[model samples]
Each structure stands twice: as C-alpha cells, then as structure tokens.
Target: MDVWDLNLRHLLAVARIVEFGTVSAAATAVNLSQPAVTQALSRLEGQIGMPLFDRRHDGMVPTVAALLLAPRIDAAMARMSSPYVTMSRLRALLALADVGSYAGASHVTGLSVPSIHRAVADLGTAMRRKLVERRGRAVALTEAGVQVVNAFRLAKVELETGLSEVAALNGQETRSIAVGAMPLSRARILPRAVTHFIRRYPMVKLGIAEGARPELVEPLRHGALDMMIGALRDPLLEEDLVQIPLFDDVPAVIARAGHPLAGTAPDRRELARYGWVVPPRGTPLRESFERHFAEVGIEMPKVPIESGSVMTLREILIDSDFLTLLSPDQVSVELEAGWLIQLGALPPELGRTIGLTCRASWRPTEVQRAFIEELAEASAGLPGALHPDLSPLLG
Candidate 1:
C-alpha cells in the first residue's frame, strides 16, 4: 500500500474508531462531528483500497485488513504526536519565559508555580535575556520574547532529531546489557560512562540496576544481568562465574569525628566494645568482618544496627557513635567533611577486590567494553596497585 497517500488526520480517525468501537465515540475524542469522522475514515479506506470496519448492528468491528493496518496507523499517529509534544513543551517553556513569575505560569500550565518560576529563571540565565517584565503581581513578555521563542523552536527541532537518532540506535540491538553495581558506584562512576557510551553508539542501551553483592550475583548467574561491579564475595566467586579483578579496596572502620575512636587505633578487643553497624549477616562484607575477627582470636561484636543501604550507613556513622567497615571510596566525602574518621584499616588480606563478574559464557558488548575502559581509566588514577589487564584498558 502507498502509505505516503495517507494523512495524519485520516490515520487518527481510524485509530480512534478502532479504539472506541464507534464513529460517534471517535468523533467525540477528536472533538469533531460524527459525520466528519466518517468522512475521514472513508477517505482513509479509499487510499488503502480496503474496508477497515465491518458495519454491525451493535458497533463497528475491525476487519482483518483493519487489524493489520491498526499497528501502522497507530505508529503513524505516535510519530505525528512527536511534533505536537515538542511544541507543547516549548509552549510551556515560553509561557514561563513570558511571566517571570513561575507561580503565574504554573497556574496557566498546571505545573507547580515554583517549578515554572525556576524554569523561567534558568531559561533567562541560559539565554541571557530579560524575557519577562515583572510589574508587581502582573507579568508580561519583553520585546525579546519573539526571538527567544524562535530560538526555542529551532532547539526543539534539534532535540527531536537527536531523540529520533537515539531511538533508532536502541532499536538496532536485539539484546541489551544489564549492569548491576552498588548504589555508591552507580552515583559516582556509572553516569559519565553511560553518557559517553550512549553518545558514541545510541543503538546499544545499557540497563543499569543497583543492589548489594548478594542481590546482584544471582541476577548475573541467571542471565538477568550482563555483568556486575561491586565487592566480589568469596561465595559468589566460587560460583560458575568469571571474575575480572578491577581494584582492591581496603575496608576501614568509620565513625563520626567526635566519636571516642576517631583518632585512636583500637585493638581487636577494644573494637568489640562499641556498638557495630553491620550489613546483613550473609553479605560478603559481614562475612569478611567476622572471618577477620576470628583470625585475630577476637569474638565478633553483636551488631546493634543492620542495613544494606550505603547512604543510610553513611548517615548513621555521621550522626552516631556506631562504627561500620566501609570501602574507602564510600566514606571519602564524610572523611573530607570531618564528619567521619577512619579509625584503622583492616588487615591487608582483608581488603576486598572490587571487580567485574559475569557468567563464564557471557560476552561483553562494545558499549560494555568502552564502559569498562572508562572504569579502568578512573581506577588507574587512584594511588594503588592496578590489575594487569586493567592497565591496557586505562591506556
């Protein structure tokens, strides 16, 4: 069929009729009269050279041709909606630019007044224009309003093209890479790597999920995740997975600055005197901590608090006397702020290797490889021993 002969209005009418099951309902949806909707449908069917609906006493039912055409017509409608969506967004931004008062724009656009105000303020800063004139409670657009709107229109077009390019890229890949990491790593490392990867090859989409080691390992084995980066627990390493060591991170006992152990190097026995903040018992970190204590001929302290969230652990350490063992990277900010102090490091062998773990059969995609490269670069900049394979990736 010659799809070029079909117009958006005709497609929309057909889609609505198919959805609502009646010409009258379709007309109501499009704010057109029933006769106008029927005319559009008639025009559409004429172009396609097939009757789309089988007229029934109860309601119009879609024929085989109609069912086949429905998906194409729906896709056409979605494509047409893209321009309108951009226009609507630009209009909202323009409305904010006109009224320096976000509250006023919010009332007009049904957005929070402060949000409208912030958008206007940000746009003004970005454009270096006084787009709005504020006279008491009233707001008005300045002479620059026309120029700003025109520029925004051009920007909207560019954005739409960029989005289309990205969408096209994602559709090219039959499979996607699922990456799992600790939340801290997600915040600090993943964003830049993801951005770089997406920009270079828009077709490969990375599905990123964050969880603790215990939660991430099963997903990696079950083929739910392509690979994971976090502390590789001994049990997880023992499984049928290949571990590529990234870097070794020394575990340190962290506590608030004013805590009694802040400047003191507490012996293993003294370490057991305080309340401990530990991860759930089954976690690699918890197991490592227990094993280390046992090796030193000391009893493991009963943990007073248990949590898996790094942020929660950080906050608890900052505000309370409770001490917890954490990767140095996790507590770097707190250490810099004087909110936390590292009492002492774990024994050298107690340091865990943060690495990439994947099923032995799993193959890394180009995007994943690039991300791993970026990670290696970041790791190499740190003052520590680097894994041999990581050196080449860093270069």
Candidate 2:
C-alpha cells in the first residue's frame, strides 16, 4: 500500500487519532463516525504496511513510525486548510502577494479581476479573517494575510517535495536542494559534501547560497532553503529553529607568516595594538571575539576592515599584519600553502558549535536525509569536531 493512496482526510484521521488517542475522540475531531474512523485507520494501516497504533484496553498507543509521520501529515494538512484552500485560490493569493493588486494578480495569473477578487475574498472568508485591504488603487495584505501567504508558499514547496519524493521511489529524479552556506560551511564542509552528493545522486539539482547567519536565517525559516550548515549558536538562539551539532568552531587568531606576532601568543593589550579584519558586528564569531577581549579587560582592536569573507581576510592578512579571528578550518588551504599563520586558538571557552540548522518543524525527505548523512561523513575529521567537554551540552 502506497502513501499516495491515502487521501488528506485519511491522513488527518491518522493525526487526529494520534492526538486524541481514541477512535471515538478522533472521530469527533475529524467529524467522522467512530466506525468510519476505525475503518479509515484500518485502511491507513494496511496501506502503510505498519500498524500505526496498538490497541489496548485503555487507549490506542502510537508507534514510532506514527510519531515520525505525524509532523509531515499535520504540516501538509495545515497547508490544505490555509485560507487559499485550493490550488486556484492559492495561485491567486500568491499572484496577489507578488503584484500587490487584484488587477495585477489577474494579469499575471491570466485570471479575470472578478475571479481574482472572488478568490481573495473567499480565502479571507475561509480563514475568518481579512487578508487584504484596499489603499487607493493598490491592495496590501494585513499581518494575518502575510502569515497566510507564507504558509501557502511553504505548502507549495511541501507539495513539490512530496512529488519529488514519489518520483524518487519510481526511479525517477525530480528534486532540488537549496543549502544556505555560512562562512565555515562554504570553506570546507558544504563544498566537499555537495561534491560527494552530486557524484552519487547526479540527477538531483543543488544550489549553494553563501551568506552570514543573519542573512540566511530568514530564508532557512521561510522554506526557501533546505538547511543551513555552519556555526551553531550557543544555547541555540532561535526557538523556531533546531540546531544539530556537528563540531566546535574554535577560532584562531591569524596573521601573515612573517608577522611579528607569528609564533608568539600576545596578551590582550598587545593583540589589540594590531589592526584587524573581523566579522561584522552581532555575529557569533564577532561576539565571541569581543567576549575574549572583554574578559581580559582590553578593548577590541582597530578594525581596518570588517568582513565575513575568508578569502578577503586571508588576502588582507597576507599583504599586511591585520590580525583576525577565524576557524582554522576556514583557512586550512591558505595556512597549508604558507600564506597565513595561526597565531593562537581562542580560549577553550570561546568556540562556537558548528552544525546544521533548519526550521524546527521541517521534515527531511529521504534524499535530504541522505545529503545530511553525506555532510556528517564529510565533516568527520574536521578540526575541533565537537570536543568531549561540549558533548554533554550537545547531547
């Protein structure tokens, strides 16, 4: 039995059963009779080749498979229940979101103004909330409308991914992965893993977007990115995001090979004497760098240039004595090629946890999970790969 054979209502019944823990209660939730719910559960179990629940005198207990499947089912059903409930309505909403007016949506979607207007109105009515407001000749979504549009957008991605997963099972490839690459990830981890992933899954398309954490977080959250691989936040800053620790990003103070600071561990004041190329303010690296100095009661060095680019920092350091803090992994090639010198590692307390970050609600497809496995393999021997002291924190 194929999951494709299960309708939305059937999946909803499964989720409801899991949530309510009894056939009668689940039937109440999904507006089906108890007998109908029981039958649907039976059919769903048969189709999936697994018993989602174990019947006992007290209640039905969900299996591990049911627990894992519940999130995807709930997410997809949420999309189906969004204000733009059908494809036509969703398309109209999306068009309006893009163009900001019913007439513009009509022009873009090749839908009549009345059709677009009715779709938007119906969406608002379905959601029991006003989505758009007219201001002069333009239409603008209210806060609630923006949220609904974002949900619809995610739903579109989810649907496409579902199709791609189905195609993969049939020995067909119709998938793409978008990765948000932070500085350390772009330098080694992501590139290496992507090369390996492509060699193995040649049919799957891949996109790599490089940016700072602040730049990538929104896209990662919005479903524009499959996942982000880079420095993990200490205490895991974003509640809506989940971080999987891969390693520790222990930064090093670096300078040119022949610089006066080479082979010498300078004190904080002496270190502050040199001009620096540091990460932009508010970054984890920058915060760590500042904390190191603050702990020693010394002001941060004069920033001759601020950048997140490893290459830029390396070139600057190579040409002059501009000290900067970076993960040694980020400048491994340059350091090996005799272009840069690592002055010293940051104090043991000053490292960032490097890892994978994704939306907390995200459910990886088989291919995406495979890619993550590839990433883990590629990052195996990376420097500072999750020190023992930090293992407990990660665990």
Candidate 3:
C-alpha cells in the first residue's frame, strides 16, 4: 500500500493508457517506447493483482480498476507539476526539505548522503531553479522550493489515496484517515464520531493526532491530516482551509467542588477577584475569558497560569482558588466525579464555535465523508448544549 513501492512514472503511464486507449499512443505521450509502456502496464496489473486493461484486437479497453485509479493518478500528476519529478528526486528533495541537511536527509531516508545530495542537485538542475539555499550554518527552502515541496506533498497524498482506494477494491481495506484533534474535539465530539464511525467501518483505521491549533495547523495544511476538529476561529485566517461549524460551545466558569464560589452563582466582578488559569492569550477560551469579565463591565482577573491542558487546569483548580473558562464537555469526568463544578455560565453570545477544519482543496473518499456525517450527527446534541439556555445549532 506504499506509494513509494509503485513507480511514479509508471503510474502516470496507467493514466495515460486510460486516456489514450492504447499502449502505442500512451508510450508516445509519455515519450517511452511501446514495449516499455506495455511492460509498465503489465507490472502495474501484476502489483495490483488485477488487470488494468482488457487486451483486444482493436485497442486496450479500460477495466474497472483502471477507471477507479486513473483519476487519482491524474490528480497526483497534476500536483506533481513537472515531468522531471521522479520518485527518487522527489523523495530526496522532500527529505532534505524536512531535515534541512544532506546528512540529516540521509539519516531520515536511509540513503547515502552523497546520493541524497546528488539527487537534490539533479532535481534543481532539471527544474532550472534554486531549491535550497545555505544560510550561515543552516539551510532553508527558497520560495520556489516551498511551492515545489507543497506540490510534492499533495501529490503524495493523491497517490496514497489512490493506493488505499485500489486496496479497498481488492478487499485489502487499507483506507485510513489522519485527523488532527484540537483539545475540545478530543474531549467529546471526536471520540463519539470515531466510535460510531468504526462500528460501520471496522477496517478503516483512524490516526488521531492531538494538539492545540498552532501545533496542528501546519500539518493539516501540508496534507498530513485529513481534517482537524475543534473551535473554528472567527474570520479564519487561513484562506486554504474551510471550516464547517458544528455547534457553539458556551464556556463556563469552573472551580473545585468546594471552592468559595461553588455554593453560589457568582457575578463577573466576584469571579474576577480570584486568580485564573486559562489558555494562552490568543486562544478562543482566553479571549472569551477576557470577555467573561468584559461582559459584566469588570476588570480582568490575574492569570497565574496559561495552559490548554485539561489535566493541568483541573489539578490547579482543584488544589487552588484558580478558575478557568471551559466547555462542560472538556471536564465532564471531573464534574461527574464531584471534583469540579461549573460555577457560572458565560452568555451564549460569548461562546466559541466548534466544528471541522479541513483543507479547502481536499476531495475526501467515501469513508472520510461517512466519518464527517457521523460527526454531524454527534454534533446534533453536544455536551455544551447541556446548559439550559443554549441548544446546539448544527450546520
């Protein structure tokens, strides 16, 4: 199921054969001989353990496997951008781009340092452009190099997706989705969706990468994650990303069960008197925390610690007078265990919107779409909706 195992040029030949209808023409289009193209097709069919074309007296007739794989190959080739992008050169550049030195690239790829160095050099010469530039002791990609890297990454995504799709057709069930889980999403929505999703798709694996937005966003953009789920930033800064709002999460003032504010519903002024533990300043929760006081026309409280870790926030709040603004879903276990209590709820207007964030250009496979549907169903009633006044408004 590894895209690297399959020849990239041969994959292109498969698409060309699908397009041109004969090995002779596909060979001409790819600038290879007819025998080579025929051999490539035979190799592909052998590797996939399925015929790509029906040999006929008149011409090559595309099979279901060819039809299924051709578009994915075409999409991948389109992203590859240049005909000079061989698998070896592509791997070398990506490895060097990732680790920043020929020695590091060699270590990552297990290729000899000279091999990686020569491959990258050949790639630059083939493209007639500078890809990497030395800066003092370090090296970095040029703007053109960054663009090429992005294209290669996306092309890899397309090829991998095609490989998974073909594997599924053969009943191999290699399809998988890599997801970036923001804190709130992992706390509730992601778990619920994943449980429902796997019941219907037991063979498809889900790799969940949990992190805050800043940590996960780059991977999401680089085609490393199929999607990210959590708070949707207002006026979302990334033009390449598309957000689908699942619901609004109205945060609450959370304190220990027997804290001074536990017995009573405190006003903003009273809540602001004690020290607070909140997410970093720029995050949605912290902005809402600031608004929690601003809404009541009170000065902000002193923040002794800034973190997004539920465990850290829970421990500090339990042991001290510090309070934090959080969705009830984020600390449901502690609340049920009598370790924490929702001291007061922020007005629904000041709440954060939770949802899915995915690359704008992504075309998800069937299983990925099904997972999204499961997410939507789970969002129909969220833990944040447990608050009396705010109901989940599903998108």
Residue pairs of candidate 1 with colliding backbone atoms: 102-117, 169-203
| Top of the candidates by lDDT | 3
Which residue segments of model 1 deviate by more than 4 Å? 1-176, 187-192, 195-199, 235-239, 388-395
Best by TM-score: 3
Instruction: For candidate 1, write residues 251-278 as lDDT tens digits.
Output: 7788888998766778888888888887
Cand. 1 TM to true fold: 0.51
The alpha-carbon deviation from the true structure for residue 72 of candidate 2, after best TM-score superposition, in angstroms, is 5.0
Between 1 and 3, whose lDDT is larger? 3
Model 3 Cα lDDT, one tens digit per residue, 1-395:
56767888888888988998888889888898988888888888889888989999888999888887898989888887788888888899999998988889999888899898788888888888899999987779999899889888988998888778888888999999999998888887788899999999999999999899999998988899999988888988878998888778888889998898778878778888999999997888888888767766777899978899998999998898888888887899999999999987888889998888888778888788888888888888865542221111122
Residue 281, candidate 2: how far off, in angstroms? 3.1
Across residues 1-395, which tens digit of lDDT does each residue of candidate 2 receive? 32334555666778887898888898888778989888988886665556789999999899765775666667776765642375577788889988998888989878999999998899789889898998888899999999888877776666566546545554667778899989888877788888899898899988888888888988887789989888877777678888777777678898899999777778888889989889888778888888988897777678868998888888888899889999777888889999898888888788887788887777777668778887877777876665223222222
User: What's the residue-level lDDT of 366 in candidate 1?
Assistant: 42
Q: Is candidate 1 or 3 superior in TM-score?
A: 3
